[model samples]
Target chain A: MTISTTPVPEPVVADRPPEPVRRPARHARLREWWLGAALVLPALALAVAFKLVPLGRGVATSLESSSGFDGTSFAGADNYVRMFDDPVVRSSFRNALLVVATLPVWVVLPLVLAVLIHQQAPGWKFFRAVYFIPYTVAPIVVGIMFRQILAPDGPINALLRRVGLEPLAIEWLNGRYSALFSLVAVALWSFFGLGVMTYLAGLATIPGETLEAAYLDGAGFWRRLFHVVVPMLRPTVAYWSVLCASGVLIWLFPLIYALTQGGPGDATMLPEYLVFLTTFQFLDRGYGSAIGIALFVFVAVLSIFSVRHMFTEGTRKPR
Target chain B: MNRRTAARLGRYLLTFALVVVAVAAVYPLLFTVVSSLKTQAGFAEDPLGLPAGITLDNYLEAFRRMDMPRLLLNSLITTVGGLVLSVLAALLVAYAVTKLRFRGGKLVFLLIIVTLTIPSQAIIYPLYQTVLDLGMSGEYQGLILAYAAFGLPLGTYQLAGYFQQVPDELIEAARVDGAGHFTILFRLLAPIATPALAALAIFNFVWMWNDLLLPLVIMGGSDSKTLMVGVSLLSGQYDVSVPLVSAGLIVALLPVLVIYLVFQRQLVSGALAGSGK
Candidate 1:
């Protein structure tokens, strides 16, 4: 399958007739196979030892009960059952759902910005460069910075007070809904730059004549955006949507850790964060593994489309 | 309004909104840098105000309290080590799968790409146990290996795509000259693959440096904490000075900020490569 996909060099095919050199070619091919295996062995070993092996063990660990310094014993599905009744686990998944529900905003906001920038909006270059600055800062740093900024007596509230919005100057990270909202907003802020970059790459694949035709036909910006640009960007949009959806579950650990630590009354608890707390902090390896496995399953279901898309996309011949 | 005038107004509003978002994006970091230089008392009196008197006390204190040098060293070692290992693995695997075209190359490529969907969180605990079982817990190699393992998928995916573009004739020519795969890969293809490798390196560097989870979990209360872990711990401390924490945040952010400024193009392109179809 792999050999058929890649075109053999034309000169080799042209210069060397098939039957005459078949014997030496077979020898060379065997050598090539060995060389490929040798090159790939170390990486394959690392992946298996670290990733594949642990993945299976992680599932196994999830099914067992262990506590304190005691050795493990099989608990069957007790941990999974307990997860359903655990308020923290329940809310963590609930918050994860809430964050995932914000996927449209995550996808569309950067996309719109990318479109505007793609149109060469005034200062687009500067906007392109400056907008990515937040993404460069580590999420933990972003979280820590915002923790102070969102403190009740912090700059955000102070500015609100200065602007005569005293009532609106409430605790940003201390309230239930507000903390979750703040997290979503902050995560979006830190990530939208990459979204924009992705969309721009997608946009670059689009030919100019199509947009030019739309312009010449008197389509306005919004019309051109929705009509001409967006349809062409479905793959990119799907890509980002899948990325953000999974990201909301997996990638927000640092932000949650630094900003709210699953926050004011479990408002910001995510399953991934809860897994960390449960496994590392609370020492409930069985339950934490359960949550981890559950999160992994959810992410896998969500990622199937994108994974397939990316697989074909990655292997597709470069244009 | 006339269509032309309305279009002009829309353009103005669009630019204005873009500027506003740009400021929103950059303002927090500027706020942190400025506030880091302010006296604590000054910060308390007016948290939003520009500093009354610039002071380096917070930075100095942060450096001392956070053991800045040690954290920096730990972060440098892991980031560089992870970057080198992952990029090399990706480069070699990409070359093998793309150029070598041996049997099962497709399966090897597929296995690596599929791992992209597996989030580190899912495997965190077991991965931790594996590291501990190997007796590499709290060691540099443990975290480095984990980073390299996670990083391999994306790097290989991107580099394989890049490698596919290199015509087969190049490798064939080298082979005819009596070059083996290793020599051709390192001496020949590696240079050709430099742009892709550099972009992958920058991308992985930023991620591995900024990452807190692997280091935090694997290092596990060890003194050899990465800078992000150190900053996180600093924030977690009770009665922590906001300014001091701000300084620590800046300290953690400085390397990434410098990398961003210097390799802005590569960084942006790397991001593009990450998501590019």
Candidate 2:
């Protein structure tokens, strides 16, 4: 160690003259840094202005007690404590968990459909268009349309009634047992297009020769799918899982707010909907902020864990 | 079966299944269109059947209630503004990173990449607060800026990926000719990147046009309320006219439908291409 240190000092002295030449390069590097800064400053400014700065304020707001978005003072985590004791919050969180359970239908169905669609057959373009059309329509429109279809006297019930199945004709949107299912159905209708499209894109990146080789070995569709296509599609599956999981939490607001309004005794209440209620309808910004923060923390933790797991599990080492 | 016959059989079965799925997928929209022209009694009596009488009453009523013309203009303005700004900002950052080997280039790109994992739910509180603080809670600029920030990362990442496909030799030749980076990028690269840009523009436009939450949160009380928000309000207010509300929704969504039909290919491909998540 002493010998290494002595020689390192001699080299440091010998290499000192290039420091002057390296200075302009350093300046040039600084200029490059400025250029990179210049390029990225707009996005950074926007992110801070729209995301981080508001996060700070939101945290502050959550800690304070307020009445009708006014007269707020530091209330600490009382709001959080209240969330545990509040039956509505507990029920809503439970409902959200229930809604999340429906994710496999979105996550898994799309992969299967994508594989089916990726055959690139005679009408591949048409099939792709067909699958993607639903996404082009607004979610609100889809929700309204489903609301009509799922109404007490809507087509679905009318069909059941005509079949002399009165029990099957139960009110779709209002019943506590049925409301969550109705919301899930609406979600499937609204988002399945995007999911299918994403999967199709992922499937496109998979080299065909590998699947063909598996096929030549007399591997059946199931075998090829399980052994070859699935392993190849791991990245897409992981990406969509993270995206869809986050979406299961965030995007439910649209359908919930649109269709149920967390109604029929809060059977379909979700955290996002609850946040909206607390902040806007109830005018308790402080409590609203707490709920918002809690929701964020919950989602962030889940997303990080899932993403980390996906990267570790699905990541393929380069040969 | 041999390869040719096997491929042929696979095509047939897949196409058949797809046709069934397509009809099922399109049935609701087709049903809506048919129902929109029917009387309330007709709709209730036979929801799936063709209208007993093709009446324009629903549409006219919807137009009146929704202020369809103004709503259309507002949606267009916000969407177009969002599309242009998002594409431009994303292009600058993407081009700078993928085309130039500047210092901290990888770091900046990596930061944007990391943000892709950050769920929108985690950031909304802060974003909402920021919009409130900037006194832009009810303004078009606020919504546009928010969309730009939200859309930028994905847009930049996709465009940067596309930019990587632009041969470096072309850029090097331009550099040798003493063209400034901006000149080569704008004059040379932009033309080559038109297809990707078009796809990005269409995708961003559709997303902004359809977004309910941002406009709902930021522009609720003001005239800045978008078509989605308008339709949502209509949905919530029960005992209000249902036909008129449906009509309003139909009218609000017509432009998007038209645009989708026009750029159907680009829209589909763009969605598939940019759908990294």
Candidate 3:
């Protein structure tokens, strides 16, 4: 290889370089700042004004119990103390834990369902769409539909009558043991699509060659899925599980409101519903705000942990 | 048998199972529509079957009792207003995060991500008070703002992904051509991002349209209530009219059903693909 260079002489213009230096005009700088500010301002304003400010107010509100409009009187941390002491509140807490335990079934079933549909077996797209279609419908609509279907003259009763298993068709959402299960069923129906979608994306990243290699090594389907596919999809599983858990807690609003209305003797009164009752129904803004703060802190902590896990795992695998 | 042949057979079976599932999914809708057309006597006689004698009385009763037209209009205004605000604000934030280099860009993005963790219920009470304090309670603007707050994070995340896919060279060329940031965003990026924008719009449209809580609180007055609220109120203890409620639900759900059928693929793709992150 040969390299050649020409020596340059700077005798012509000793004061400056030959190329002109073009500084960004004032308008461009102004525009850059304006654009940047414009982009950051709306979201910032929304977050602070809507989220942060309200959160602060909620904390302050929790200290006061107003009997009339704008007649709040501070009671220190009595609301928090009351929250711990109240039997209904204690039961609500216990009920929430029970619901949380069932969260795993909703989380894992969706992942398993997603994997079932993501497989290259056949008609996967059709199955995927079929499962996902329910997610598009509003929770209100599902609530209304289930209300009818679980009613005495609904299809389930008719089906059971025909099968001579009439006792099996009982009041679903109105019964104590069955109401929570019904709500869970609805949640699974609505959100399993999201899980399926998430898992499909994870499956997309697993190269076909990897699966083929496993098959060639005489590994069976369940063995490959448990050993290879599950390991590769850990990040996705973690992300979805966290997301689904938080979503179950937050998005249970519509389902609870529509189906049970926290009914069958308050068997399904979630924290969100309780917050509503406290604030509006009972006119206890302070206590409602306290519950709101608690719910926010709970969701925030879970999400932070999950997102942290995602990043750590994601970094290790270069995802 | 060959693997291909076996796969083909499996596909057939899977498709058949899907058909059955789809039918099951749509059955409630069919029942609603059918029962709406039936007379009260006919419905009571055969609640699970087709009505022997059909009538539009349920629709008329539902419309008259629920004030369907006004409720529909209220829903439309709130959804449109909420969608416009959410999409614009989200796009602006998304554009900034994806394109501009700034010190707090990542922080702003992280803030949006964290906002998703803050459920609307968490802030409902304070938000209600804030709305009252602003003197905008029971107003469309308050409802729209609430919906926008809920929808902003998802919209920004989705739009950011869409914006990131546009080639850097295209943006660079536009910059060199003396196009300002606004011009590039409105003229160049807007057209390219239309499909994604449409998908987001549809998602927000359904969300805001079908939402029962914010409007239930902010717009609880008779003149201001949304479809969800109206339908819910109609189903209250005094007048537990199943047929009337079903009719109202169908009316409330028709627009969403139409949008879903028309853009099912895009909505599913955007939702699934976005969550893949």
Q: Pick the candidate with the highest lDDT.
A: 1
Candidate 2 residue-wise lDDT, A1-319, digit = tens? 0111111111112322232212346665676566667877887676666656666777888888886736768898888898899999899888878877877778877776777767555677777777777778888788877787787877788779889998999888898879988888778877787788777877766677865575556667667777887788887777787677777778778778778888888988888888878877888888888888888776776667544543332222222
Instruction: Give one digit per residue, the lDDT tens place, for model 1 in A1-319.
Output: 1222222233233354233312347777898798899878877877887888888998899899997679999999999999889999889989999998999899889988998887789989899988878888899999989988888888788889989999999888889899999999999999999899888878776777875576446666677777877888888888889989988998899999988899898999999899999998899898888899999899988887776875676577656
Q: List the candidate 1 regions with Cα displacement exceeding 4 Å.
A: A1-24, A215-217, B269-277
Off by over 4 Å in 2: A1-29, A163-165, A213-220, A302-319, B1-16, B44-46, B113-126, B165-169, B238-241, B271-277
Q: What would you estimate as the lDDT of candidate 2?
A: 0.72
Better candidate by lDDT, 1 or 3: 1
* Per-residue alpha-carbon lDDT of candidate 3 for residues B1-277, written as tens digits (9 for 90 to 100): 9977976675677556556655765676787888678777777778888888778888888788778899889999999998999889888887787776555666686776567777778888888878888888889888888788778877776677667766555666555555667766766777667767877888789788878888988888659889888876755542355676777778878887788778878866665554444
**In candidate 3, which residue ranges exceed 4 Å CA deviation?**
A1-31, A67-70, A120-125, A205-221, A305-319, B1-24, B165-169, B237-239, B272-277
For model 2, what is the error of residue B256's alpha carbon versus the real structure, in angstroms, after optimal superposition? 2.0
Docking class of 3: acceptable
Q: State TM-scores per candidate.
A: 0.93, 0.87, 0.87
Task: Using TM-score, give the best candidate's number.
Answer: 1
Evaluated on CA atoms against the true complex, candidate 3 attains a DockQ of 0.32
Q: State, as a TM-score between 0 and 1, how close model 1 is to the true structure.
A: 0.93
Candidate 3 residue pairs in clash (backbone atoms < 3 Å): none
Residue-level lDDT of model 3, residues A1-319, one tens digit each, is 1111222221132243333325568776666666677777877787777777787888898888764467888899988888888766666666677778887787666665566566554666666766666766777777886787777778878889899998888888878879888887877777676677778767766777875575445465558767877788887887787887677667778888778888777788788888888888888788888877888888888788664542233222112
Worst 10 residues of 2 chain B by lDDT: B114-123
